[model samples]
Target: MTKPSRTYRSELRTEQAAATRRRILEAAGACFAESGYGRTTQAAIAARAGVSVESVKAQGPKRDLLLAAFEQAFTGQEGRQPLAEQDQLAAAFAIENDDAFLDTGLEFMAAANRRAYALWRALTSAADSDAEIAPVLDGILARRRKDIESAVGLIQRRGLLAAGVRVRRRVAAELSFLLSPEGYQQLVAESGRSHREYLDWIRSMVRATLERMEP
Candidate 1:
């Protein structure tokens, strides 16, 4: 049997390292979600990942880990990319029918909320007390506002948005509040609404927001 080449070995090691980092980030997300940032320790994350404490430390400090984990949970990768450019949004935009496009958009938001809500909760709580986290939270919010503007542009192109909605600032602000994680948390987590019920609320509220705008 032939031995693996040096290049092949190098590639394998890189893949293994990436997988380990993913595991550690996932563990970190779980810890932050369950215990909150104040209480979650690297040792706990290491145990959750089934890796050594040294390995967890090798990744980063807890604050860095929290941001990385939140990014991964929310976007399925680093948070470097704009949310609108993601493949999921592209797929949703491909639908030509206005109502169908709106439905797809809502479903996408609902899915994202479901995946990231817990970690988002942790992130917001941490931002309140952690100076380092507050700037990151602000940056994320700014990015989200940009994303909302992008979405509104797409909706305008589809001729679904009213003439009044062409002013992106006002519309984006309304949409941001409508689709906020806090609203999701109150509806689904606090109010005991099922996922479907929460989605229905999103559909109704967002649709109303769009239609009620003066032309």
Candidate 2:
């Protein structure tokens, strides 16, 4: 049996979908970058994407929309996949090997800083709880934690981690620290350290912690 070829119009449709999704993400990232989390809205993201508000809504509700935008910006990929690899997750977190831990973690903090704070505030305040965003937010955090595991594994592999670090305990704690939005608000916000400085400390602290636990 012969397989049917994709019609030209069908191919065009696929391309258009790709472009639309990209536009939504780019606009969301730009808006979030400029306005912080509290100010950005679906209408704003739609305008940024050059689409109707309905289109943005159809693309996703608030959680999905934000997740889509952040994932794209962080990983250079579509929404989260089930079995993602370490290097890929690292890329999604915007960390390259060329980036020192501080530099890479700092970039991620900048991208996530406002959004994380805002989303958390929303979770606590509105509806007396987050009706929908909680799971999405949790998923994002889980992924980030996994990225730390990947990074810690790399450190261990290279023997950059100290001689006898306990792998499981260190990875768990480091993940908790890196994934905590409260840490961001306290250190990056109230502590008066610049986001860059705090992130550097996070990297250094995590590395030091992990190295100390090396086995």
Candidate 3:
């Protein structure tokens, strides 16, 4: 059946908006990655995008900053699938890349981890005493959940997730650690493994777990 005209236009508009948002996000990501969340201000992010501070604020409120980034980072896999729908097992199997599915999957996963970790560290630290920062922290976490849920849907469709494990709970934990700058930095500071090596270990372990539960 042919799709509706309005649907197409709506998609086009969304694509445009997303593109603009992505430009801003990529810039913000670089800043956050380098400066840590506490150090990077919205003005710096706007400068990276060559836009004004007000434009950045208008583009999205500070609370929505990470949300915008998370939305852009993942390819919209709203990967949640009910366990009962074993028929759509294909959803769980991600990354049809020639470069080893696990490797590619973890590459994106690490990217997501870095972004989320920055948000988490900033929000959590801010929320320690300031009540105003509470909502911003919640907003960041809410977006992360949405993205992970999308990933979970893909896993359910492909049945690639480990069996017998609580899907939502497991995804949440994996995402939490995978994109955790704090955890990554801690491991780096204490364990002496380079970032590249640490990510490899992470990717391998996550994939192995999937193989055990779903393969």
Candidate 4:
């Protein structure tokens, strides 16, 4: 029997490494979400992932792990890329119908909230007292605002934005405030609203904002 080529072996190792890294990040996210960042430990994450503590530490320190896990949960990747540029939103961005685009955008927001809100709540609490985590939280919020602006720009380009919506920055800020993870945490996680009810609230608030801007 012929042996596998060196190049094939190398590729297999790379895929395995990527899979291991993803597993560790996922475990870290779950730990942070359930235990909070101050309480979560590398050992705990390793136990959750069924890997060694050293392997978890090999990914990064706890702060890096929290940020990476949050990013991965939020954007489906551990990077600083804007949401407008992410591949996950490509199909939604390509929708030419304004109604369809709005629907897709809301669904995307709902899905993202479902995936990341718990971790986001953990991150928010960590930022309150952890000096190392505060800046990271600021950066995440900044990126979120920029993403809202980008979405507004896209809507304007498609001629879907209302004529009365003259101040885009203000509009973006309103959207950011309205769609904050804190609100999601309160309404869905703490207040015991079902996911569908939370989504309906989002749709109502967003539509009300848009309606107010209609000329």
Local lDDT at 119 for model 3: 47
Residue 69 displacement (Å), model 3: 3.3
Tell me the spans in candidate 3 whose CA falls farther than 4 Å from its real position. Answer: 1-19, 30-42, 70-103, 114-116, 129-181, 188-192, 207-215
- RMSD (Cα, Å) for all candidates, in order, is 1.6, 5.9, 7.6, 1.7
lDDT of 2 by residue, 3-97 (tens): 55679678888899889888887787677656755567988988778899987877866656555666665556566753234253355444445
Candidate 3, run of 10 with poorest lDDT: 77-86
**Clash statistics: count for each candidate:** 0, 8, 22, 0
Off by over 4 Å in 1: 163-166
Between prediction 1 and prediction 2, which has the larger TM-score? 1
**Model 4 misplacement above 4 A:** 163-166
CA lDDT of each prediction against the hidden true structure: 0.87, 0.62, 0.59, 0.85
Instruction: Compose the digit string of candidate 4's lDDT tens values, residues 76-125.
Output: 88789888777757788998787777877887788778889999988889
Q: Write the per-residue lDDT of candidate 3 for residues 10-129, one digit (tens) a residue.
A: 999999876766688777656754675567789999999887787677776554564445444433322223322322222324446423654655565555444454544544665665
Q: Which lDDT value does model 4 have at 167?
A: 54
- Candidate 1: give its CA RMSD in angstroms: 1.6
lDDT of 1 by residue, 1-215 (tens): 99999999999999999999999999999999899999999999999999999999999889899999988887777656888777777788898887888888888888778777889999999999999989989999999999998888777667777644446667888989988878888888888999899889889988887787634
